[model samples]
Target: MLIAMAGLPGTGKTAIAEAIGARLLRPVVSVDPIESAILRAGIDADQPTGLAAYLVAETLAEIVLGAGHGAIVDAVNAVDPAREQWVSLAARSGQTLKFIEVICSDVAVHRNRLEARQRNLPRLSEPTWHAVEQSLDEYAAWSGPSGAVERLTLDSVEPLDVLVERAVEFLGRPTSS
Candidate 1:
């Protein structure tokens, strides 16, 4: 399974993706840390590091899927191009692709979470609330359901346990015998 998680900053995308990865015992590949690594490796932060990081993560996920392991990708895949990459990858890898979009329906709560978040990685700069609003404005609408990929929408208002359980069900994981 290739679980591609998408959402704007502060929408609990990372939290949900991490929880799902843990529950399924799958490796989680995130773009932010990859971008941070690029910067720390003497690359200028002004470069197109975000795209580079996404490609790096794509390669990593491809490797994981090729190795016969499920992989979860965590990112703000707000654009069609980025989303399309994962769809293509799953096709090439012969893995079932699940696109999960996490959202915080409550605007006030989302803003609070954005403002209160502390960056654990020093090299990765955090996005401001205003930036998140801009991203929300530019986020592309989904291209509708297709046979090639499964879509799941999640509202972060639910408890983490509930969210994780719902994700497991959405992914069609079989329970232990």
Candidate 2:
């Protein structure tokens, strides 16, 4: 299975993806880490570096799928292009695609989380609340019908384990012990 998680920063996308990846025993490909590596290489992540990071992530996902193992992608795939790329990749690889979107309905909690969170990745700066708010505003609402590529929208207020279990079940797969 190829699980792709998408949402704005501070929405618990990483947490959900990591938990699900652990449960599924799958490799997690987070865009933040790739972007950080690109920046550490002295590339500006605001431009070409960002594009390169996505390409690198896509390549890695392909390799992971080719290895006959499930993979989870953690990204703020706010637009159709980003989401479509993963969908297309999974389609060609004959891997089941699962699209999960994490959301925090409580604005105050989301803001707090965004402001307090830190990125441990090298040379990667955390986004400000303003930036996160901007992303939330700009996020394109997903309208695709759910089927093989299941869409799970989770509230961050819920327990992490519950969210993970729900994701596993939605994918029609058993939860990891």
Candidate 3:
């Protein structure tokens, strides 16, 4: 199985992904670290690294699935193209694909979380609340592949453990739920 998490930054998508990965014992592939590595390796700051990062994550997921293991991807898949790429990857790899969109519907709380976050990855600044708002403004409506994709939209206003429990239930993993 390939579990793909989507939503803007500070929505708790990464935390959810990590929790799910730990619960399911699947490798979690995050695009942020890949993008940060690219920037650290002297990629021009102005260069578009999102696509490259996604590609790297896609390859990592493929490798994991090929090894007869499931993988989870943590990324801000706010657009159709990004979602489509994952659907394609799942189809080619013959794996069950699930998309879990993590969101904080409360605007004020979302902004506070975004502003208060510290950058854990070296040389990679966290996106500002304004940037997150812009992303929400541009976010595309997602519809999974007909009859083949499973999708879930989670409101991340709850506690982390509760959110992870919900994800485990959604994934039908017996370990946590």
Which regions of candidate 1 fall more than 4 Å away from where they truly are? Answer: 144-148, 173-177
Q: Which stretches of candidate 2 lie over 4 Å from their true place?
A: 143-148, 173-177
Clash pairs, candidate 1, are none
**What overall lDDT, based on C-alpha atoms, would model 3 receive against the true structure?**
0.85
Candidate 2 lDDT, 75-172, residue by residue in tens: 88887778888888888899878789888999999999988887788888888888987776778767553233567788988888898888888877
Alpha carbon lDDT of residue 134, candidate 2? Answer: 77
Quote model 2's TM-score.
0.90
lDDT of each: 0.89, 0.83, 0.85
lDDT of 3 by residue, 53-139 (tens): 899999999999899999999999888888888888988998778889899989888889888887577667788887887777889
Error of 3 at 28 (Å): 0.8
Better of 2 and 3 by TM-score: 3
